[model samples]
Structures are given as C-alpha cells and as structure tokens.
Target: SRAINADTGVNKQLTQMILKWRRPGQELLVGKPEYKSVIEASLGIPCRHDELVMEVMWGMKRFMPSLVRREKSELPKEDLLPVSQGLQMLLSSYGFDVKPEMVNDQIVATASVLFDCDAAEKKQYRDFHALGRHLKNVSGIEYENWDLLKLATAFKIITSFLQ
Candidate 1:
C-alpha cells in the first residue's frame, strides 16, 4: 500500500505539472500540494476544481484564525472600517438609520441599561458580553471595559438586526 501510494503520488504530481503547463497562465501557490493530495486520495485518482474549492473553504475555516489584526493603513483595502462597521452594516441591512460612528455610543448606553436592569436582564447581557470577550481576544484589540461593553452591544444589535 505504501509503494502504491508513493507511485500514485508521483504520477499525480507529474499530471498536475503537465496540467499546470498546458492549461493556462495560472500557477499553483504554496498550499496547493496538500489540497491536491487530499483530492487525489479521496477519489483514488487526480484532483479536480470542485474538490479544491470545497477543501480550501473547509481548510481555511479549520486552520485560519477568525480575525487577523493589521494596521488600517497597511491593509490592502482602503474602505475597510473597524469592527464597528460590522454592526452598522447589520443595522443597515435591517433598514436602521444608525451610522457606524454612532454604534459605539449606542453600545455604551445599552450596556449601562443592561447593568441597571433586573437579574435576568443582567444574565442575558452578561452572556452577550461573554461572546464579546471571546471575540475581543480573537480580534486582538486593546479594548477597555467600555470598548468591550460596546462590542457586546454591537454584537447584540447586529444579531437582532439579522433576526
């Protein structure tokens, strides 16, 4: 089985190289080898495009981190906003007239309201806040209490909007 696997792997590599050269100007990048192997192994034959895309999405979700921290100026896209933008877009989708800049303030007030509410309200709010805490670490933000509260509120607002 090991010798067969080795032979088949070499054959697939040669086939991939031939296909790469004969097909178009497109070239495979770094991680394609693992992906190609997965596809070939699954079918006991060569890899295909459908398998590649499916595998890439699954692999990215499995291995890649949720949020990547980078300087706004260093980002490839100029129009990208901070995490607050996600909240605004969610609200926008629900036809709310909320601006992205205003989300921060809204969240602060909402969190304050949550804190002052009854026990059940406090629990619910805390649950949402916990989710925000998880995301804060993932986002790699230097968030204060207020910022975290705002993030939690933003998450609630967006989730509600989506629903």
Candidate 2:
C-alpha cells in the first residue's frame, strides 16, 4: 500500500519544525509519550504519521552502546572510609537517587561515621549515632535508644511473624 504522503505530500514546514527541535540529545528520549508531545508541539505533525521513522530512530539508539566504544578499568578500594559503612548502607537504599560510587570520595573526605573494626571482627555491635542515622535514612524511622543488633533482631522477628 502507498503511504499517505504519496496521496497528500509531506508537510515541509512541519518537517523543518521537527528538524529544528530534534537536537542531538533529544534522539535517545526516555519517555515516548513525552517525546510525542514535544513533537506535536514543535511540528504540526499528526500522531499517525510514519511510526516507522520513530521505530527506526529508537532502534538505532537502542543499539548505540554497541556502536560506541569505551575503555574500562578497575577502581581502587577505599578501606579507610571517611564516611561510615552504616551511612553508605543507608544511602544505598535509595540507589536510584544516591550513587555510592560517584560520591564516595566526598563521603570519605567528610570524616563522618567512625566504625569499630575490632568490634566487627569480634562479632559485637554497638549503639551509635550512625545506626540511628541509617534507620532514618533507610526507613525514615528514628529510634532514640536502639542498637544496631537490637534493630536487626527486631526486624528479623517481625518479618518472621508477618511471613
């Protein structure tokens, strides 16, 4: 079957409008509906015109990582962390919002959250400001007098009961 453009020619003005709006970063758009809205606003193009074009553009972009090349290397570890493991664990709960690797140096330089490595080796947990901060960060729940082990034990018991 012949395309509609064969019957009624393509809108040159709309084409030009789309060309103007379609800068480099706009190609790999995250949301299709939002992209459609932008296209509709920029060009007077109807919703139905040439879904094939969108399909091909999106398909090419989906494969772009394969097309592009990069060099990978192992990152050095930060054992002497300025930030506490408790805080990193807390922030990691919001992994979408907080990238631990990206801000790790800043966390380390801040010199917050000291841990007792000796106690960890001995399998002993203690009450500290960091654990309270972790509970607050992870669940937005603040307990005035709760140790890390107590919190873990409580959570374990509760989860078992609920299950």
Candidate 3:
C-alpha cells in the first residue's frame, strides 16, 4: 500500500467534526439530521448521507493514536517479552508496525510516537479496532479492555489455526 497525504485545512477540520459528532453503533453513518446540516453548512456544499459516511470512514482510517511512553517499571521482562513480540508481529503483519514493549504490565511501543506511517498503514489499525469490536459483539468479551497478557493470549488462540 502506498502512503496517503495527511488531511489538511478544511478536510482535516471536517474529519475532526465528523469524529466528534459520531455516535456509537453509527460509526460510519451520520444518524442525526442536525449533524448532517452542520457538516454541509461547514463545507458550504451540498453533500449526501453516503458521502458523509465515506468521509467518516476516511477520517477513521487516518485517525492516529497518541502514544505516551511509560517509564519502565519493575514488571518482569520474561513475562512481557513473548506478549510484546507476539503483538509486534501481529501489528506489523497488518502494517501498523507497533514495536510494543512491556511497560508497567501494559504493552506499549518503546517509541513515543507509533504512527509514522501514511493513511494506508493507519487503516490497518482501524481494521484491527473493528476486529476487536466484532469480537466483542460476538463473544461479549471486550477486547479493548484486555490487558497485554490477555490480548496476547487471545491473539494466540485466535491465530493458532494459522500456524
């Protein structure tokens, strides 16, 4: 996948607005008429609902996470290494390239900044998030709330058949 230019100016502003105004279970769609009207008025152009959905999806794909590096704690590296490595491989395979390290029992990248890639790479992260949401919907287990060990364990269980 090739790099996509960052959203700037009006597009960036519109993206932020769309994200801020979005509601749960309506991730891609603009459910409220008032929000739609506001978006159209902000752009000073006539836009359809589907077009707004596309814009929201586009913004989601380019959404970047703020990686705040944690100081190394007394947690055992032996316990953290395998989980970190597993996550690193899993994320790298999807083009996110998060070289996650264990910090205070959580898996975070050693680098303070994780998103140095373009929209294509960033989209992979969005896909991963969607996968998590789907898993929650199906199994009633919130993957987003899982810790590093739990995430790695679930990842291993889910991907074991591929091995």
Candidate 4:
C-alpha cells in the first residue's frame, strides 16, 4: 500500500506477477497479449508476435529462474480426458521443461497458494468476498478482479485434476 507508487508499481507489479509457479510450461505461454508486452519491457527488447515467441519465452526464463525448480512425481489422478488431453497438448505444444509426471504436482501446489476452500463451508467454492478475504489473509494484497480471475483459472485447473 505504502510503497506501490503509481510510477514504479506497474513494473514492480509485473515483476511480482510473473514470479509465481505455472504448470510446467505455462509460464512460457504468452497466450494473452498483456504477457508479451510486460515480458518485452522486462527484457528491454521488442518481440515478434509469431516467430519470436520462444525468444521472449527465453527472456522470461532469464528474468525468473526459480519458477520451475521444483518437481514432484506423485500427483492426484482425475484422469478426465479433456484435462489429460489439454495438459498433454499444452506440454507438447510449448515443449515445457516440466515432465508430464510432475505437472499435477505443480498444478496442485500452485492451487494451494492461489485458491482457498471456503472457511465456513469448506467444501463449497468461495464467493468473491471469501476469495478476497482468503487472498488477503494469504498474500496481504487487496484482492482485485484480476486476482479473482487468476483464482478462477487456478480453481478450474485444480478441479480438473481432483478426484
């Protein structure tokens, strides 16, 4: 709150944004337009929209190395075809360094950090208010719509992997 001056906050926020763990190769999937722009700025170079995706990806790797350091072999098996196919396609398409076996581990760990089961209902999904509370309690950031969107993505991924 105190330090996030409007000036440097964009860069600082972008830096913090990309530092989190993404499932195996997702850190490289700049499917969103915003990712490329921030990454390009971080690299201090422009990236091509089509051909140079890998180069920008490399820039991201150099910018944040700790993201892919952890790997786990045992993962929960929901084995839903769409989920399995989706992950497999993503892995094959992106050539993510994360091995297939470790993907679920990364997904679950990332989920643990990003989403919270409702404190009252426990099994029910948290509403936006609960999400805001949980996120604030977890990360101390005032949870915004963007954070809610991030949590939704994590929830969908985690739910797909759960039995």
Candidate 5:
C-alpha cells in the first residue's frame, strides 16, 4: 500500500479516468431513464451499490488469496482493510513505509477538493469502477469469462468480515 507514484503516467491516467467517470453528466451515471428498466429486466435482482462493490472486490481477491485470511476466533470471514487506518496498518505490516494508498480509491483524494464523495448514486458507480481498475492492476490477474463473477463474489464474502 505504498503511495501511488502520482507523477507516473499510469497514475495520471487513473486520475483522469476517475475524474471523467465521476463528472455529473457521464453516461454511466446518467443512464438513459427509459432504458434502465429494460436493462434490468433480465437480471430481475436489483443491483445495490454496496453489493456491486462487494462483488468487484470479491473478484479481485480471488486472484490474490494470500492477501486475505480468517481469524480462528470467529467463523471464517474475510480480513480486509476495514478503515483508512486499518489500511495503513496493513501496509506497515507488509513493510511498506511510504504514504499509504487510499483504502477507498474510488472515494478519491485529489478531486475531493472539487467534488462531494457522498452526494449521489454516481459516487458508488465511480468508486466501483475505480476499485475494479485498481484490482485488475494490483492483482496481476488476466481475468476472463463468466467465472470472473464468482471470483469477485468470493472475495467479497471474505472481505466483508473486515467491514
């Protein structure tokens, strides 16, 4: 969880992507009102923001099993970075001494100065997108196919314990 090299090209792209995706008028956030129900028709199950985040994180975790584990004192559960401080602690435990990356990158750091992180549904979508990118980058997985969904769900179940 070292500080992301903000000056790096990858970080710069990530920043821009996060910003663009978060802007008020973005298509993902402002889905066509009439098309939404149509899109949701087959799924039937309503998609909750927290559930989506859990799913994406779950998928990411499956590709990196060593990063999580369960405590014997309780029923098997995920042991993830529960809060900002916990994230830092996890980094320190891993021998990283630099500024810790935000546990909630989708929550944003650089642009928080210009935008509210808790304003609307868009926030969750943006965060989930950011997290999915971060997981894809950091987990080093070439995830493909429908199985990816299972991978994500598994990670969520484990990580929920730290919540």
Candidate 6:
C-alpha cells in the first residue's frame, strides 16, 4: 500500500501541476470543473474538488502579493489628530505637559531613530536628550523645553508592550 502523506512525490507533482495550470497571467478562477477534469486526466486518478480548491487557494495566497502592485496611501493630518490627542493625554497623566501638535513630531522622530538611522547613529543617540537634540536639528522641531527623559520612558513602556 502507498503511504499517504503531504510530503509524498505525488503531492509535489500535484502542487506543481496546479500552480502551472493556474498561473497568474491565465487569470483562471479556482475550482472550475474544467480544471478538475484536466488534473484528473493528467494524473490518471480522481481529483477531489475540495483538495484541488484548497491547493489553488494556497498557491494564490502565497504568490499573489509578489505579483500584485500595491499603492501607498498617506493619512491626512485630521486623521492623526486622535492619535496626537491620545499621546497628549497619556503624557499629561504622567505629569508631563506636552502640546498635542508636538506629539506628531515626537512620533516622527521616534520612528526615524528606530527605522531610518544606522546602528552607529542609534548608539550615538542612546541618551534620550541627545536623541531629542539630534532629531530637533534634523526636523527643525523645538525640543529644548520638552522632557526628553519622560517621553523616552513613555516610548519604552509602549514599545515593550508591542514587542
């Protein structure tokens, strides 16, 4: 008796056949009767409809992202107001008086340091105040009076939860 398992050669061949028949350029919908008939004839065995559908869906899910072009959408300032307001409230609760408008700048600076900066630059800004000064110069945002230590602490607390 043949051992039936997902890693079998027959399964690999079936996957390859399904992928080729449903190539993205062909734009053929999955689970079509004609597709099942073709697969049955090619393999000289019965093709279960549910199994074929599952294989086709899996193939599309795996490959569609690379084949499709996605547009970047920018959020308007008004949409970010709630986020700024929430940040302001959180800071105020921690006894830091921060303006809501400054919250946006703070978020941008934090993201820039975390994602855009090189490892050396990130190390250079290890001190919260140093990070604030560097970001202020780069973004032209005034950070002279803001409490960098408190803001950094808040970011640490929030990011810890995310991680």
- For every model shown, the clashing-pair count is 0, 0, 0, 0, 6, 0
For model 3, give the 10-residue run with minimal summed lDDT.
1-10
**TM-score, cand. 1:** 0.21
Q: Which ten residues in a row have the lowest lDDT in candidate 6?
A: 1-10
- What overall lDDT goes with each candidate model? 0.48, 0.47, 0.48, 0.47, 0.41, 0.50
**Candidate 1 on 25-77: residue-level lDDT in tens?**
44333234565564356433454455445445433432243334332233212
- Candidate 5 Cα errors over 4 Å, as ranges: 1-119, 141-155, 161-163
Flag the better candidate by lDDT, 1 or 2: 1
Q: CA lDDT of 71 in candidate 1?
A: 22
lDDT of 2 at 35: 46
Q: For residues 1-163, write the lDDT of model 5, one tens digit per residue.
A: 1112323222345446545555454322211332334323422223223434544544344324334554223212333333334334444654655342333334323234323433444565555555566657877654333243455574587479769
Best by TM-score: 3
Clashing residue pairs in candidate 3 are: none
Error of 4 at 128 (Å): 63
TM-score of every model versus the real structure: 0.21, 0.19, 0.23, 0.18, 0.18, 0.21
Q: Give the best candidate by lDDT.
A: 6
Which stretch of 10 consecutive residues in model 5 shows the poorest summed lDDT?
1-10
Q: Which residue pairs overlap in candidate 1's backbone? A: none
What overall lDDT, based on C-alpha atoms, would model 5 receive against the true structure? 0.41
lDDT of 3 at 8: 24
Q: Candidate 2 lDDT, tens digit per residue, 98-144?
A: 44445554543332322344346335444445555675887787665
lDDT of 4 at 113: 42
As a whole number from 0 to 100, the lDDT of residue 95 in candidate 2 is: 55
Off by over 4 Å in 2: 1-17, 20-31, 47-61, 68-163
Q: Write the per-residue lDDT of candidate 3 for residues 1-163, one digit (tens) a residue.
A: 0111223223565567655766544533443455456545554434346644544543332222222234333334543343333335545655764433433223233221333454445575566667678778878887876644565567678889778
Better of 4 and 6 by lDDT: 6
Between candidates 1 and 5, which one is better according to TM-score?
Answer: 1
Residue 27 lDDT in candidate 2: 46
